[model samples]
Target: GGGSSSGGGGSSSGGGASAPAPGPQQPSRPAPGPAPAPAPAPAPAPSGNAAQVAISFAKAQLGESYILGGAGPNVWDCSGLVMMAYGAAGIDVGSHSVSSQYNTMQARGRLVPFSQRQAGDIIFWNDGSGFYHDAISLGGNTIIAAPKPGDVVKIQGLWGGSDIMPYVGRPG
Candidate 1:
């Protein structure tokens, strides 16, 4: 019944945690003495320290061209640059468009009334219509952002009509 292995019977003599018999087919190249204990799986990347890595990467790409919604080593839009920068830290931001990005952040917490934001958080804006807008927290007063078309990636003052603000996620 078992697939063509060199075992005499499909069944094993003992159930769980029994030592394997040295059969011709089950040939242990290292030869069975004491089987080495299985290695432990690697741990998940820490989402908390992830943002710091992304921020450091972004800082290096300061003068990159500003492409509308472009994520690149070349040109980049606001969200794209932020996403790419964060990506360097081994974090994946699932949204590209402003609203898509906003929804992803919203799934985390609230806006409008404004909440206290930490570094590596997200901010979304609605330009009166339902059109998307966004930015990332740089901590303190400045924010790392691709302000507009023709503008290089730069840190800008976060206020005025720039309604988009922080969606407090781990700064990884």
Candidate 2:
């Protein structure tokens, strides 16, 4: 009877020992100490004004070819150019879709009428289907965009059309 009781206690103690040991070990091990290494990732992240950085990066891609879904480094589409430009500035809108990009701006920034838009504002246009084109404003009524499938990234005058309700979004 005594042996049975001691065996039960020993079994429970053995299990409890491993469980608590691992729990403390996880926190005590160097695992958390090396966590500081990944902190540098956010350190080198884009730190300046988002619009300025985005505009600078977008302008640098002036001659890149336009592809329907390209995301830069050479080629880009309308929304892809906008996304990559902002991403380079450390403001990720998290998508390649024009509508989704617009939503991100709507959530993070304020809408500015076309008449009051400034350089670096994100301007949007309808692609016949709806508001499906995006560009980086260069102010003075010009914009940097990938245009269309056969075009290259270039600065062009903003389109004036009532059919397309063009709008501007200022980054935060």
Candidate 3:
């Protein structure tokens, strides 16, 4: 006689069943803020030789979308950006990782100091962590970087963090 149509007098997990969710479910935490953006690609400051090709490439893609490993008219990563930029300028320099690019140029005495950074130079930063971040020094303390996902190629201060730049590897 006391039968009820509402769940047939049974409990429902939909706000009615009082069963807490499984194990220590941590409260929703926001994704950590993305690392600082990279500097913009600098204009040709030296002899203005073929460096303008890189400058033109970077300038043309000022707002292109940035995907971690993307390399195209739509998306690009830090290294991919550099590879494409120089490639557009007819330079054959190509590197997959930030460190590899750095090492490759380092062995050739292309690495330069931040003070001597010129347009088209590749800057790599190690935040004391194992991973590294990179950007193209467009001179004037501005660098071109593809940052992380959801971030497009943009210009920001050369340094992403407290790292004042320990070294820079110039891409010829």
lDDT of each: 0.63, 0.75, 0.72
lDDT of 3 by residue, 88-168 (tens): 877655476777776766666666667777876777877666436787777878887888788888988766666545667
Where does model 3 exceed 4 Å of error? 1-47, 162-164
In model 1, which range of ten residues has the least summed lDDT? 105-114
Model 1 lDDT at residue 70: 87
Global local distance difference test of model 1:
0.63
Residue pairs in clash, model 2: none
Best model number under TM-score? 2
Query: What local lDDT does model 2 show for residue 115?
Result: 77
TM-score of 1: 0.64
C-alpha RMSD by candidate, in order? 11.9, 12.8, 18.6
In model 2, how large is the Cα lDDT of residue 1?
Answer: 45
Put down candidate 2 lDDT per residue, 23-42, tens digits, no spaces: 44454446544554432223
Q: Please report, as a residue range, the 10-residue window in candidate 2 with the lowest summed lDDT.
A: 39-48
- How does each model score on TM-score? 0.64, 0.67, 0.66
Please write out the lDDT profile of model 1 over residues 13-45, one tens digit for every residue: 664545675566654467568888886533322
lDDT of 2 at 39: 27
